[model samples]
Target chain A: MEALLAISIGVLVAAAVYLMLARHVLRFIFGLVLISNAANLTIFTAGRLTEGMPPLIELGQVAPDPGVANALPQALVLTAIVIGFGLFAFALILMFRAYTTLGTLDSDEMRIAEPREDDA
Target chain B: MSWLLTIPLVLPFLTAVAAFLTRESDWGRKVSVIGNVVFLGAAVLLFSHVYDKGVIAGQMGGWPAPFGITLVADYLSAVMVVITAITALAVSVYALSDINTRKEYLGYHALFNILIGGVTGAFITGDLFNLYVWFEVMLISSFGLLVLGGSKAQIDGGVKYVTINLVSTILFLSGVGLLYGMTGTLNLADLALTVPALENQGLVTVVAMMFMVAFGVKAAVFPLFFWLPASYHTPAFSVSAVFAGLLTKVGVYALIRMFTLVFDQDIGFTHTVLLWVAALTMVTGVLGAAAQNDMRKILSFHIVSQIGYMIMGLALYTPLALVGAVFYLVHHIVVKANLFLIAGVAERIAGSTDLGKIGGMYKTAPFLGILFLIPAFSLAGFPPLSGFWAKYVLVAAALEDQAWIIAGVALLVGLLTIYSMTKIWAEAFWKAHPEGTDPTLATLTAAERRNLLLPIGGMAVLTLIIGFFPQPFVSFAETASMQLLDPSPYIETVLGEAAQ
Candidate 1:
């Protein structure tokens, strides 16, 4: 399970990197989402996969048996997901504004904001 | 008693939410001012407590470390919190006049509060992953602030800024994952205890490199710094000033913490790389400054250069060097923020930040000129200012280590720094204004003058206080550096016997 998770994370990272290299703004945002998810999975896998484990402790268990899945990584992953969502939303809005103002989604074409020779 | 640590993190966030909810109301600005003042008071209380008690620890959700979020305030964190609070308060006051003129005042204030909250959170949090979360909070809010005005220049700069920082976040996340995977822990103090025991030094080195690259990009180190000057000066003056003052220094703070605690092995390899990077960062950043014609752009480039000095002390890895790094970090934060605020005033009084269009401000606004001069010279490492003592300690550390090349680079960078300051001084203050310029540029109205004086006066007073009686601050930094260099104290305070 751990090996499979690791491989999946590697694949996700590769895909994300490819998307990140694209010239368009939306693709970059998508790339960031993929990268964040890949990171989440990587952390999940690093916690070591366990089989047949519930997410939390059963109510009123005397010993509070240790068989439940690790909750820390899950909590971290949940936070990462929310933060990733925030970044994606912000990036999407920013990209939308850029496209509306510059009339293109290609980052290379948005050169008007670059410092011009006559600026100084 | 330990709960005081939570106030610094919670108050600004609550205020931010309040500011957001009151966006349409006329009381938004007033509420922001009051809330920030309260936050500043909390910071002062936290600082005084930490000063007396040494380090304060709070375990969130009533659970001990390794199970819950922990907030720890050592000397370094406390000092940084004080600095952040003061700068935020000054910026908040300055923004009152500045933001009222803008269309997005509410969002601006909301984002500003969130940024301060995030920075303070980052400083106080003892958990490594929690630190990453706070970093995201800071970065996201900074992104919003950078593009608040939505000008073409802002949007353009914001894109590069967001893209680079997004990449950095991913890298940082990956690093955290790797470190946690290797050590089975994410608490910094726990990691400090466990990291040295790992058999795979190479793996830890890779993780360290990932962190260095992530923070290097954020801190605007030599090769990773291209995005800074491209984006920083494009924002409005307030936005640029705050970003210049706070954002990159957070990255430097992260580097200092990580190197001192988690990655103390192979100092030759890591610290040597840092030394060379410091040298290159300083040289390239100053050259970038020299190449700029605008006042803010020049200052922005110098930010990168001065960051090199702080990292230089980290790379040297001596006690004196560490003390110097801490001292320089505090000095740089204030002086840089002051310089940017002065730039804001200069633009207000002179009608532009472009050196080509601005001149002869000495006659019209001598106070502003004097305000600019103190921090400017301080930043240039002139004697009798805090900047000089910072350099003195750093250079003394390098010489003690017999690292002649690093010491020489430090001296040369100091000279170039002075040269950059002179460039601004001569172009903006000493030269004559051309004929037929806008008559409004020659003078400021009463309100504008007052708005400008508030931040300048606040920063000038700080500069003078730190410059004259630096021993107390230096002693505070020395204690902080000692705590950092020996992580046992931090670990014992955080994880109890498990850390042992």
Candidate 2:
């Protein structure tokens, strides 16, 4: 199961890299979303898969059963997903604002901050 | 005992709440400044606690080591938190005049305080995951600060800055996951205990490189620093000054912490790679600055170049070298931030930051010229200034290592740094204004002058004190370096008896 998840992560990352290389800023945001999801999966698989077992402790038990899944990575992935979502949401709004004001999505054409010196 | 650690971490959040509540009134800015003054007091108390004690650790909710989250401070973290407060206080006072009411109404003070909180958390966090949380806190607030005005240039710069930093953030998260999988613990103290004992040491090196790249982007080192120059000049002067001084150094601090504490097993490979990156970063950064004409852009690129010296000190991995890195970190924060503040003043009086358009400051505003010279000359490594002592220690350490080539690169970079400073001096200060404007300090109102020059002069005084009296600061850095080189105290403090 871990091996399969690893291969899928590689595929997702490949797609992310391709999309992020585009000049359009929206594509970069989409690429970041894809890549962050891939990172989440990497963390999930790295925790050593325990199929179908919950991490919760049984009633009157000292701890969760030995075969239960590791809960730490789940907690970490959940935190990461939330943070990544906040960043991408902000990035999306920023892109929309850039598009309206700068009038183009192409990163190359966004030169108001660092204008070409020769033109000046 | 833990209150010493908790006060500095918690005070900023409380201040942010107050500032946000009072954002519409004049009381908002005053509250921000007053809160920072109190925050600095808390930081000094923390520093004194660490100075008297050794490495100090406190676990939240009373959970024991390697389980509950931990907050720890040694000399390095203590000094960094103190400096973060100092810079925060300086910038908040400057913001009294530089930030407009529209921006204050937009919660600028709130975001600024939160950013300081995040930087403090990063310095004191003992858990890897908690550190990631702090990075996100810092990143999100900075995103707001950078684009608060929503001007054309700000949004343009914000997009690039947001995109690049997000990528670096993901890389850092993935590295934590991989390292956790190997060691099964996210506590840095625990990782230090387990990383060397791991069976697959080679895989540990791979994770180390991932962290290096992640933090290299944050530190704004070579090949990964384009985002900085692309965006840094777009923000308010106060925003840019704090970012210039504190942000990248957080990256360097993380590099110093993780490399020395958790990733020391393969120094032969990791440190060598860092050495090459340091050299290239210095050369490329200085060259990049040479091509720039704006004052802020020139100063931004120098941030990258000076980072090379700090990284060089770390790469050499000697006691004296680490001492140099620590000293360089503190001195650079004051000098670099002051230079940006001076640039703001010049922009206000001269009506532009463009070197070609603005001049006559030397003739019209000689006091401003003198202020500029203190930080600029110090930045160029002139004698009896902070930068000279910083460079002197690093070069001396390099010579001691007998690493002739890196040492030569270090000196050449210093000479080129002087060239850039001189370029700014000749164009902006010595030359006549192309538009024939006087650009004198008298143009500013009395209140504006007080609000602006106070921080600039205060930091310049700090630079001079560090320069003229280097003995105490150098010894502090020496002890900090010793703690870094030998982390037994840190581990024992964090993990308690189990570590022993």
Candidate 3:
């Protein structure tokens, strides 16, 4: 299970990197989203996968050493996911505005904003 | 005592919400002023308490470390918090009249306050994940503030700035994830303990490199710095000044903290890379500054060059070098912010930031010229100024390590730094304005002059105070450096001895 999760994360990271290298502005935003999700999975896998374990609490009942899952990584990942969502929304809006104003989504075409010698 | 940490972080956020709600009233301005004053008092109180009682840690939601978020304030964090508070107060006051001219002044203030809270939080937070969250807070607010005035130039600059930072955030988050996977912990103190025992040294190096790249992008080091010169000069004076002073330093601070604590074992791998990068950053940054003719653009490029000095101290990794990095960080924050504020005043009087279009300002605004001169000289590492002491310690450290090449590069960078400052002085101050220049440009209104002078005076006085009384600041930096070097005290305090 751990191996599978790790491999999945690796693939996700590769896909995210590929998306990031694209020139389209929207693709760049999607790349960020994919990268963050891949990161979340990586953090989750770091805790060493365990099965049949409930959320880190113990109840009064007979159970076979109810090896609870690691709660710390879960908490951290949860916070990161929320923050990543906020970043995604921000990027989406910014890209939309860029598209409307620049009349193109190509990152290369955005070079008009580059510093010109005459600008100084 | 730990509760004092909440004041700097919470007040600005509360003020921001209040400002947004009361967006149309003078009451918003009053609230901002009151909030900043309270924040200044809190910072002073926090500094005193930390001086008496070492580092302070606060666990949020009543849960101890490993479960809840922790805010830790040591000498380093406290000093930075104090700087943030004082600088924010001065900039806020200056923005009172300056920001009102724009349609989105209230929104700008909201974003500005949030950015301050984020920077202060980043300095104080002990949790690694929490640090990233605070960075996003700073980044998002800065994005809004950078484009607040809504000019075509601003929107253009904002696009590049926002995209690059977003990419950096992704890289940083990915690094954090990989690190958590390897160590099964998110707390920095916990990582400090666990990272050393990890088996795969190669993976640790990779993670460390990722952090370097992410922070390098923010710190504007070498190859990753192109976005800064491209964008920093497009914003309004107040926005550009604060960003110029504080934003890049946060990145340098992260690099210092991580390299000292988490990646200490990867020294052979990472330190060498850092040394080469620092040298390249300095040379290239100076060359970029030399090519710029605009006052702000020149200063903006100089920021990247100065960051090389701070990174050099870190790469040297001596106690003295760490102290120098801390001192340089403080001095650069004040001097750089003051220079940008001077640029604002110059632009106000001359109607342009371009050096060719701006001349003879010293004839009319002599105080402004004097204000610009102090920091420019200090930034060039002139004697009897704060920058000189910082460079002296850093150079001494490099010599102690027998890193002569790095030392020579640093001295050469200092010379180039002086040249750039002289160019600004001669072009903007000593040279005569051309005939037929607008007469109105020569006159400064009473309110405008006050707005310009107040912040510059505040920073100039700070530069002088730190220069004259270097012992206390040096002692504070020494203590902070000690905390960073042996983070055993930090880890034990946060996680208790049992966890370790």
Candidate 4:
């Protein structure tokens, strides 16, 4: 399971990188979404995946049973997922707004902030 | 004591919510200023506590260290928190007149307060995961603050800023995940104990480099600083001042923390990489500044250049060198933030930030010109000023270490920094206004003058205080560096039971 997850993460990162290199702002944001998922999967795989077990302790007991799946990475990945969702959602809206205000999505043309001297 | 530490962290958040609810009216500005005053009091209290007790650690909900969330303040953390509160209070005052009604109604004060809280949390966090969370908090709030005005330049800049920052955040998180996989603990003190015990030191070094790149981008070091000059010059002045003062320094602070605490296993390689990165960052940043004519753009590039000096101290890793780093960090934040604030007033008076278009401030507003010279000259490392001593110690340390090349680079960068400052002094202050009108402070209303000049004057006085009374501040930084160089007190405070 760990091997499969690692390979999938590798492929996902490769695809994400390719997409992120695009000049279009919207496509770049989509690439961010893909890479953020890849990061989540990496945490999931790195924690040493275990199936069919919860990290819960028995009633009134301290510490969970041995050989149970690690719950901490699951929790960390869950939190990363939430934060990434909010950030990328904001990124998408920002790109949309940029598209409207700047009238172009091409990164090269969005140069109002740092305009070419020749243009001036 | 924990509650005292909690006040600095919690009060800004409470302020953020209150400011948000009242952002539609003048009350938002009032609440922000009051919040900053109360937060500054809390920072002073925390600093006093740290000064007396040394390193203080408090676990949330009464749980012991390494098992629960922890807030820890050593000398470095205490000083940084206090300085952050000072900058926030000054910027909040400046924003009262600088940020317009439209932006205030768009919830500017709330986002600004949240950004401050995020910076403080980043400074005091005792867990690696917690630091990343605080970084996210800083990032998201900064995103909101950066584009609050919604102008085309702002959106364009915001897009670049948000995109690059999110990429860096992912890289940071991946490093945290991989480090956790190897050590099985995210608590920093626990990691310090566990990191050396891990058999795969090679993998540990790779993870450390990953962290360096992740923070390098955020820190706006030599090759990775494009987003800063692109975005920083476009934001609101108050936004840029706070961003200038706190944001990148958080990256530097993290680098110092991780290198001193957890990543010391391979300093020969890791710090050597940092040494070269530092030199290049200095050279490239100053050259970048020389090409810029806009007031904020020049200052933004210099931000990248000045970061190299702080990193140089860290890369040297001697006790005295770290003292230089600590001193330079505090000094740079004040001077840089004050420069941006002065730029805002210059723009308001002259009607443009373009150096070619605006001039004659020295004759018309000699008061503003003098205010500009204090920080600008200080930034350029003149004697009896803060930056001179900062550079002096760093160069002295380099010479002590027989690193002549970087010593020369440090001095050379200081020279070039002066050239840029004098360019502003001559063009913005001395020359006749290209439009043939005097740009005087009298043009502004009395209230605007109060809100604007007060903070600028206050920060200038701070630069002078640090400059003239170097003994106490230098001694404080020396103590801070001693604590940084040896992390046992930090580790013991946070993981005493686990380590024992």
Candidate 5:
């Protein structure tokens, strides 16, 4: 299961990087989303998948049973997911605004901040 | 002790909340200034506490060490927090004149304070995960501040800045994950204990490189620094000034911490890479600055170069070398931020930061000229200025190690820095105004003059003080470096007897 997940992450990251290299901002943002999901999966796979019950103890038990999965990475990935989602949402809107105001989605021509040699 | 540690982080947050509540009123500016003063007081208090105690740790919510989030301050963290407060105060005062009303009602002060809070949190955090959270907080608020005006230039700069930083964030997060998988703990103190025991030292080095790239982007090193000059000249001068002072320093701080405390194994391999990066960063940054005609753009590129000097100290990883890094960190923050503030004043009087367009400052506004000279000379490594001492320490550290190549690079970079500073001085201050009008201080209204010059004068005075009184500051950095070299005290303070 870990091997399969790792391969999937590799594929997702490859696709994301390919998309990220595109000239358009929206495509680049979509690449960001894919790469972010791949990062999430990287964390999950790196933590090592286990076939076990949830990390919950019985009423009188002091800890989860010995066969329980490692819950820490899950918690970490969940936090990353939430933060990544918020940042992606913000990035989407920001790129949308850039599209509207700059009137060009092409990253190459978005040189208003740093002007090109001949243009300046 | 815990109270002291928490105050620097908590005060600005409280101020941010309060300032946001009153952001629509004129009171936001008032609250920001007062909040900065309180924050500075709190930072001084924390500094004194850390000085006396050696290292102090406070567990959040009374949880035990390595279990709950810990706020730790040794000498380096203490000094950094203190400097952040100082920069915040300086920028807040300068913002009174620089930030117009539209940006103010957009909650400029609130975002500014939150950015400070995030920087403070990043400095003091004892958990790697906690540091990531603080970084996100810093990034989000900085995004707002960067794009507040939403001008064509700002939005363009904002897109590049935000996109690149988010990529760095992902790399940082993934590095944290890979590290946790190896060590089974995320508390820095705990990781410090476990990282050495891991059998896969090669994997450890890989993760370290991940951290290096993640932070390398933030620090704006060599090839990774294109986003900085593209974006920094777009923000409000006040926003740009604080960012100039605090943002890159945080990345350098993280590099120092992890390199010193957690990833001390295989210094031969890891630090050698850092040494090369340092040289290239310095060379490229100054070369880039030499080509720029805009005042802020030149200063922005110079920031990249100066970061090279700091990282050079880190790459050396000696006791005296780390001291140089610490000293340079503090001194550069003051000098760089003040230079930006002065540029804003010049822009106010002369009407542009473009060198070809603005001039006559030495003839018409000698006071402003003097203020600009302090930081400009200091930045170029001239004597009796803070930049001199900063560069002196680093070069001396390099010579002490008998690293002739690094010593040469350091001094050569200093000379190139002088060229850029002179370019600014000659074009912006010495030459007659191209439009044939003398740019005088009187052109600014009374309130504008008061608000603008006060912070510029105040920071120039600080540069003078640090320059003239280098003894105590050097000794403090020496002790801080000693603490960094031997972080057992820091680890013990955070994790108790288990650290041993």
Candidate 6:
């Protein structure tokens, strides 16, 4: 199962990298989303997968029983997902604005900030 | 005890909320300036406590360290927080005149405060994941501030800045996951103890490289720095000044922390990589500046150049070298931020930041020229200025280590830095204004002049103070470097007696 998950992560990352290499800002955002999900999967897998074991303590117990799933990585991944979602949303809006204001989604054509110099 | 550290982190959020609520009124900018003053006071308290007590660590909500979020400050973190507060205060005041009412209504002050809060949190976090969160906080707010005006150039620049930084953020998050997978611990103090004991030291080195690339982008070193020059000049001058001063330093601070504390197992390989990156960052950055005709763009590229020196000091891994790095960090913040503020002033009065389009400041505004000279010369590493001492220490440390090429690179970069500063001096200040305008400081109102020049003057005084009185600051950085080299005190404070 761990091997399978790792292989999936690799594929996701490879695809993400390919998409991110594109000049279209929207494609780059989609690539960011994919790569970030891959990262989330990594954290989840690294926590050591466990089945039928919730990280919950029973009544009159101070701690969960042995073999309980590690909850820390889940918490970290949840946080990452939320932060990544917010960033993706912002990036989407920024790309839309770039399309409208700059009139093109191609990063190469966006040269108003750093104009191409004639001397160089 | 925890509250002492929490105040600096939380006050900025409180201020941000208040500033947002007041954004419709004239009170927004006023609240920002006042809030920063209070934040500075809290930071000073934190610094004083850390100075007297050595490393200080506190767990949030009274939870034990390694099990809960840890906020810790040694000498290095303490001084960074203090300097961050100083820069925030200066920029907030500068914003009073520089930021327009339309921007104020757009919640500029709120974003600025949140960015400060994020920087402070990054400086103080003792958990790796916590640092990642703070980086996000800083990144998001900076994105807003970068494109706040929604101009075409700002949008173009913001897209690149946002995209590139997002990649770095993902890399950092993955590095955190991988390192945690290897060690089963995320608390920095615990990792410092566990990383060296792992049998898979080879894997640890690979993870170390992951973090190096993650933070390399943040620190704007070598190949990863293109985003900075692309976007920094497009922001509001106040935003650019704060970004110039505090943002990249956060990356440098993170690198220093992770490398010194947790990733020290195989320094030979890692530090050598850093050494080469340092050399190239310096050379390419200064050469990039030479090609720029815009005042802000030249300064922007120079930022990448100066970061090389700091990284050079860290790469050396000697006590004195780290001291040089720390000294350079503090000095660069003040000098670089002040130069940006002065650029803003020149743009305001002279009508352009393009050096070719604007000039004659030396004759009409001698006072402003003097103000610019203090930071400009200091940035070029002139004697008795802050940059000189910083460069001197790093070069001396390199020579002491018998690394002649790196030392030569350091000195050559300093010389090239002088050329760039002189180019600005010659074109923007010394030469006649291309359009034949006088461009006097009298062009601004009394209040505008006071709001603008006060921060520039205050920071100039700070640069001079550090330059003239290097002894105390050097000793402080020495002790900070010592704490970094041996984080045992930091560990003991965070994880308590059993960790020893």
Best by DockQ: 6
Q: Evaluate chain B of model 3: give its TM-score.
A: 0.97
Ranking by DockQ: 6, 2, 4, 5, 1, 3
> Mind giving the per-residue lDDT tens digits that candidate 6 earns over B1-500?
88889999999999999999999998899999999999999999999999998998889988898989999999999999999999999999999999999889899999999999999999999999999999999999999999998999899999999999999999999999999998899999999999999998999999899899989999999999999999999999999999999999999999999999999979999999999999999999999999999999999999999999999999999999999999999999999999999999999989999998999999999999999999999999999999999999999999999999999999999999999999999988999998888999998999999999999999999999999999999999999999999899999999999978
Candidate 6 structure quality by residue, lDDT tens digits, A3-83: 999999999999999999999888889999999999999999988899889999999999899999999999999999999
Candidate 1: list runs displaced more than 4 Å: A55-68, A116-120, B101-106, B436-442, B497-499
3 versus 5: better DockQ goes to: 5
| Clashes (N, CA, C under 3 Å) per candidate | 0, 0, 0, 0, 0, 0
TM-score of every candidate relative to the true structure: 0.96, 0.99, 0.95, 0.99, 0.99, 0.99
TM-score of chain B for predicted candidate 2: 0.99
Candidate 1 lDDT over residue span B167-276, tens digit each? 99988988998898899888888888789899999888889999999999989998999889989887767777788888999999999999998998978789899999
- The C-alpha lDDT values of all candidates are 0.86, 0.94, 0.84, 0.93, 0.92, 0.95
Query: DockQ of each candidate's interface versus the true one?
Result: 0.70, 0.87, 0.52, 0.86, 0.79, 0.90
Mind giving the per-residue lDDT tens digits that candidate 5 earns over B14-110?
A: 9999989998888999899999999999999999989987999999998887878899999999999999999999999889989998999999999
Segments of candidate 4 deviating more than 4 angstroms: A59-61, B497-500
Provide the TM-score of chain B versus the true chain B for each model in turn.
0.97, 0.99, 0.97, 0.99, 0.99, 1.00
- Which tens-of-lDDT digit does each residue in B1-500 have in candidate 3? 55888877798899888877666777666666677878888888898888888878788878888767888887888888888888888787777756763544438777888998899989989888899999999998998888776666666678778888988887888788789879877778888989999999999999999999999999999999988987889887888889999999999989988899899997987998999999999999999999888999899999999999999999988898899999999999999988988888788778788888878777766777777878898999998789998898899989999999989999999999999999998988878876436423237677766766788898999998888788888888888889888887778777877886
Cα misplacement distance, residue B416 of candidate 5 (Å): 0.8
lDDT sort, best first: 6, 2, 4, 5, 1, 3
How do the residues B29-128 of candidate 4 rate in per-residue lDDT, one tens digit apiece? Answer: 9999999999999999999999998999889888887878899999999999999999999999999999999999989999999999999999999999
| Candidate number with the higher lDDT (2 or 6) | 6
The TM-scores, chain A only, for the candidates as listed are: 0.86, 0.95, 0.85, 0.93, 0.93, 0.95
- The top-ranked prediction according to lDDT is 6
> Root-mean-square deviation of each candidate, in angstroms?
2.0, 0.9, 2.3, 0.9, 1.0, 0.9
RMSD of 5: 1.0
